[model samples]
Target: MRYFLPSKRLGFLLLALLLCGFALNFFMQAASLNMDAMSVFSWIGEYYWLYLAGGLFFFFLLLVFSMILPSVYAGSAVAAVLCIVLGIVDYKKLSTTGEPLFPWDLMLLKNAGEMSHITKGMIPPLALAAAVLLIAAVVWLLFKLPKIKVSLPLRMLFAALSVAMITGFVSMVAHQSSLAVSMKYQNIFWNQKVNYKQNGLLFAFAGNLRQSLIEEPEGYSRRAIEEIAAKYSKLPDPVPNVQATQQPNILFMMDEAFFDPTRLPGLSFSEDPLKFIHEEESATPSGFLLSPEFGGNTANIEFEALTGMSMYFLNDGSIPYQQKIVKMSSLPSIVSILKERGYRALALHPYDETFYNRNRVYPILGFDAFTSEKDLDNAGRITPEGYISDKAAVQEALRELKASSDPAFLHLVTMQNHFPFTKGHNGPNTISVEGTSPSYKDELETYTQNTKLTDEALAYLQQELLTLDRPTIAVFWGDHLPALSAGIYTDAGWDSEPRLKHETKLVMLANFNIGKEPLNTLSPAFLGPTVFRLSGQPMPPYYKLLGKVQDEMPGLSKQVLIGSNGALTAFTPEQQQLLDDYRMVEYDLLEGENYSQDLLF
Candidate 1:
């Protein structure tokens, strides 16, 4: 009963651990460390002073929070338990390139079997001894301090001094390279303070939180490349091989935010840039391509359309540009397959090659040649502050495509309509679209204007397509929904409530003298397979697998298995089953838990 006084001793201990834990987690998640203490020390020397200053500030913040909210001690305990649980759920995400274990800085081996030599060898004994000593010291002080009945001022002074001492110790530890000690303590703190269950166990895990909260980087990892290539090497039986007796040049154009909300039958755009796309005296048109994401992550959509494999089929991580995470196997495979069949594959973009590690990834992804800003003839073309105009990119693509031989495949990704829509131009004739938004009155007008600019660029590209003599297959689709100030679906009168808002269509136009007709193909994954089918090319094994699923689930195109509730919800029941099957193969391949020979075939 006495221990539960106005100033509970556990409060101080909890604050100390919580502050220390967060600091430790930061080091573990970002810094690389060695097992040898001396090596870690050498590295820590460079940044220890800064760490000390930060630690001093953080410790006081936690101390004040504890004094203000006594119930926070109990809350911290709950948080710690949740953090531990979530660490287990997303253990696979801990793999980093230079520093993989940093993500798992808070996770302690729950079972004896998981105990590595460091834990079993020296850490467990030292940690147990330190913890017991610290607990015993606190209990002894609590009992003795109250009995002594010291003056309130002296007690306060002593507490402040103790806080200072602890802060100094944390600073000393912070500057050391031996991240194991810091990470271990941080894990202990997270277990005591942060409730991991707020976002689900995995979501609460330090690595997952960092990824979501930070400006996550773009690019594919080496593991992803190898996986994609391996998957591609084993060709599917009865591949969708078609003849190219009079081979037509292929132009793959991906427009930035090229989505039409009124795609639902009667709902249509006020200005139709796509009207001409559907009526060519020498063209074939395919309507309504289902897309996966909206407003961002264009590469993923491009990956799906070109590779015929959903990102769901990918390893549960970003496509690590340098082999730190995933084992990719889609786009690169598509390019490789095309190359083997005597088709030259070239990729063109107006942005820097470093934009998404395009220089490194495009080559591995199977493009025979890559042209970006480094290759752009004109060095001084500006449109908007950060983006190159879409028309300029098209002009570059056309110039390169016309010069290439051997039935080439040109992949063109545009950047003009990428966010921050402003007036700028690449050529002498500049098209400007800007308006002042007065209380959302001009929101719709502004968005329509921006979309009009993108439509104009697409129309210009189509016009250029007219001049080419070789038969050409042209396909275009939105990367994601535009970040229009007015909500895309709301402006179009779709449900405004945020629930499963990922749906867009792909439009395909072929210049083989095929009549323009509106065809209903309600599958997003069909973009890859259908493209191959219409182009008379061979479908890869991965594409065939996706093709089967798309054929079965026409309406289930834009759904993803986002973790909500306790179970993973697939976009639809059909997708749920497909996920289950994929998960089984995934577990086998990724974790060595279960293997299916069918996956190899």
Candidate 2:
């Protein structure tokens, strides 16, 4: 009759505690607009066992801890309750607006200004009641257990061990998918729905398990994984030869909200942002990049630029950063290639490394060093919009460049001009568009200001390199076009598909040495070969495979512009075959299929 034994009372008490934990966690999740059961359930089917284990373990751990360290348990319980209550308050605002929440959206809770004004103050009491009930259940079970049957030390040890095992298991799955379900099922709404359905427990449990392994269409993918790995395998060949000669220092820059200056109304510049970067520095450039995404996905650009793989090849609407369904090479592989050739490779982003899972993916890609917001000591200098100034990034680059003994390959991504164009937003760095064309003023202003800042930084950098004893190469290009507001889209006669037009862009750029020649234009897709040529590395078979086509019909070689022309239309057949071939090869490689026939081509 001991409560600690496998009795009905013990099971009921454990279930009560689990339900309370689930409700609290659910409310926290449902507080954001980007979250909901659907987003949470996306991972449930893939890792249900882990979720169940976490609940059981956490319950036992807390129980043991409460006995051993009552004060600590009291503080933790208070904090947990507060977090849940705050989440409830936030959810009240969004629920009113009919906006849903996602599991990984707790970051949005910190955005104080976006919170809804309505103060219904409804759910806190109910949440408190549930918490009280759980506490009561636990207390009742303790009292019911016979003191002689269960040793205090044994009870405590069992709880602690369960907690430790559960915590470790949950941590492993959180990165995979079970974290989503654990958060959602914690909510009363989702739990109620599962209970209402026939065989709801089995169905919900299976769904949760499915989520952990499945690819995240909106966040990350297996195809992207393989693509990244493949890009690394094809890293600029002739490593030793490239290292023998005094190779120029390489600088990779990604400018925010950048588009073809050729598309801009006024293109004159006293100081060119990327005038010197060119092919004679040994160049290979593509026509149209045909990026699979636009507006918000800077990760796709990173994936493409580093992996030399196209997002267009994967399932549409998949995000490669969040999920790891496929394994692929990354910029780090290029870093490794350079490392072999006595070069130092580094990744620089003027933002939080955690934003796009850069912290997780950067090392896998092969970079020796990563510099992010944490690396910047002066946090105040960073923009209010959660981004460090590109100028700061350049400063750090200069410092890092001076310290490195070997030729360096640096990846620098800038974020100054990211959309929402409003004057006075970024302090002294703001570009004034008051006198410019009123129609495109807001949109143009942000780009002009950000571009101007980037230009100034580059001009200073060029001068800095002049002081450097060794030769250097700086490659700079726009990540994507500016994100125009809805007003401009509507005003500019965009009725049917405004999102598509805004997405269209020119992504090719100058691949110049300190003072080298420049190509008239090229596509972003051609960058891999272009990098190989610039670095004096051997082109793999595929680069040559596409290189001949570019040579024969240079006009037809643009990466993304094949939709309009007759010859281009005819070439689609060949392109599709190439895509299929590449896809199968990529998949096979991910599946660990070893091939004697090199697929490097």
Query: Number of the top candidate by TM-score?
Result: 1
Off by over 4 Å in 2: 1-244, 260-290, 325-332, 379-386, 428-444, 493-525, 542-567, 570-573, 589-601
Model 2 scores a TM of 0.54
lDDT of each: 0.48, 0.49
Error of 1 at 192 (Å): 22
Q: What would the per-residue lDDT of candidate 2 be over residues 1-601, giving only the tens digit for each residue?
A: 2433544544454465556555444434334423466644544354445345534444554444443443433423544455555555445434332222223233334433322211112345687699789878756655665432234554566567756765564444434345535444331222223221211222232333323211222323445435534754554443321342566677777767665433333334333333432212233232333334445557767765665544544433234554442234433234555666787889988666775577767776778899986787773343465356667777788788878888888888877666445554455434344433476675455555566666666656656767765566566666655555444444445435422333333322322332233333333445555666655666655554334333332222212334332224345565554544444443443323324024453
Q: What RMSD does model 2 have?
A: 11.3
> Would you give me the overall lDDT of model 1?
0.48
Candidate 1 accuracy as TM-score: 0.55
Quote each prediction's TM-score: 0.55, 0.54
Which 10-residue window in model 2 sums to the lowest lDDT? Answer: 194-203
Write model 1 residue lDDT over 1-601, tens digit each, in one string: 3432435454456455557655543333232222234533553455454344434544454443333333334333333434333333233222111112223233233323322321222223786697679667755554554222223453355357647755554454333224424432232212211322111121123323223111211233334334543554464534333455666677788777665533523333445533444343124555554555544556666665554445444333323342321234323345666677788999987765654455666776688888886687573344334356666777787788789767788888877655433222222222222232244334334444445555566667777778877777777766666554443345444444222245444566655543454445343445655667666666655555545555455433324322222123335676565544433333333323212223332
